[model samples]
Target: MATKMVGFVWAFLIIIGIIYALLSGNISAINDSILTNANKALELFLNILPIIVLWTGILKIAEGSGLLDKFSSLLKPGLSKLFPSVPKDNKALGYISSNIVANMLGLGSAATPAGLKAMQELQTINHKKDEASAAMITFLVLNTAGVTIIPTTILALRIAYNSSSPSIIIIPAILATASSSIAGLTLDYYIRKRNK
Candidate 1:
């Protein structure tokens, strides 16, 4: 897997190099762009750290206060119906619910650990020897196409770039993410049905 990933990266770099060579007749443009972009990337990353930390810290407080569990319970009935394979009492369901809630609020830092735990719990429940179970696949799809609200990371980037209306992206981000989530789940359902 590591080798395959490395190979893919090399292939991607080769493609980019070809494009750069064809356009500029030299690699100097690419070198300069890489140096400039690396600095910008680092600055952007630093700018977002405070936002991520604040949100994740809030999530920890919510979890400790048991508010997350209460919210999870409120959401559980519908989620249970959607993910029939996951038992109501299962830890995976709790983790998944927390992860989803965090993602919906655009708290990626907060969602990471919960999502990892959910995946671990899901892997534990897999009865099959060779492949992922339907529930696991569905969860992966849901996580990948998460329903975002604030889009905090993008907002942070916008702010770093000195955008005036960073928060104005909220509505569009919510709509776009919600639509992607619906599409992902719908596709997962069809695939699961076809496989079954």
Candidate 2:
């Protein structure tokens, strides 16, 4: 459904752009951009590929060393409060912890796999697989409002663009994400209580 919506949006944008270009007599520019967009996308992918590989490798190492498990254990107490529906010794908790940690470090691309795995684990215990469970909603809220300590992608982009203070937004990012997370969790709790 989301894929279909996105496709519609892209199609709309392209049609609108072409119409505007026709009206403005910039058809050549539009054609040029259409031809070059793929190359630009490839270039961007090549630039970000090394960072993705490096971070994925580091996450793999952490997994091999049992570091992720150790961290998950440490988070169990607090995370249990947030995810009471999940089993005490569930595999879902580990993936959730890993996802949170990766997001906190601002490794968005690296967090994707763990987040997906977490959802998969979450679904196993869901009575209605077609609908989201309470724990799943809570996890989605938390992940969507993730607290980023590093803002790594933003910093990397800034550095690539030759910013004088590439890392200056770190503090602001942390504060904003923390605030968002707290607000999101509060609302989730309120909704859950109302439902009960």
Candidate 3:
């Protein structure tokens, strides 16, 4: 369904763009636009790829050094409250904590592996494999909403663009993410309560 929706939107946009370009007698601009956007995408990828690689390497080191274990331990108490359905000794908690930490620091690429591991662990505990469990739903809500602290990717992009004050966005991003996290948690809690 989502794939279909995306395809529909893309087709609609392309059709509209072509029609507008022809009507404006700037059909040549359509080809130029495509080429320009393709170049911009490549330029953007080149700028962000290094940051992703560096952070992914750092995450690997953290895991190897047992830093992730310590970090997970620190987050365990609070995580238990948020994910009460998950067993206290569950391995998923560690991965969930690691995923959250990586996301906060804006290492989304690094977080993916841990998040996948977490989901796999969660599935083991799920009695109904067909439907999402409460814990899984809560975890997904928190993960998707994000509680970004560093916003490293955004900062990196800003730097690439030579922003006057790249770091200025840090506080705002933190506040915004915090708000989203709060709202998401609140809604999840309310939904769980109502369901029960």
Give candidate 1 regions above 4 Å deviation: 1-7, 22-24
Q: Candidate 2 residues 6-71, lDDT tens each?
A: 999999999999999999999999999999999988877766566656766777787689886686
lDDT of 3 by residue, 23-73 (tens): 999999898998799889989998877876786687788879988678767
The TM-scores, one per candidate, come to 0.82, 0.83, 0.84
The TM-score measured for candidate 3 stands at: 0.84
Q: List the residue pairs that clash in candidate 1.
A: none
Better of 1 and 3 by TM-score: 3
lDDT of 1 at 178: 81
How well does candidate 2 match the true structure in TM-score terms? 0.83
List where candidate 3 sits over 4 angstroms from the true fold.
1-12, 23-26, 53-61
Candidate 2 Cα errors over 4 Å, as ranges? 57-61
Each prediction's RMSD over C-alphas, in Å, is 2.8, 2.5, 2.5
Per-residue lDDT of 86 in model 3: 91
The candidate with the higher lDDT, 2 or 3, is: 3
Ten contiguous residues with the weakest lDDT in model 3: 147-156
Q: Assess the local accuracy of residue 118 in candidate 3 as a C-alpha lDDT between 0 and 100.
A: 94
On TM-score, the leading prediction is 3
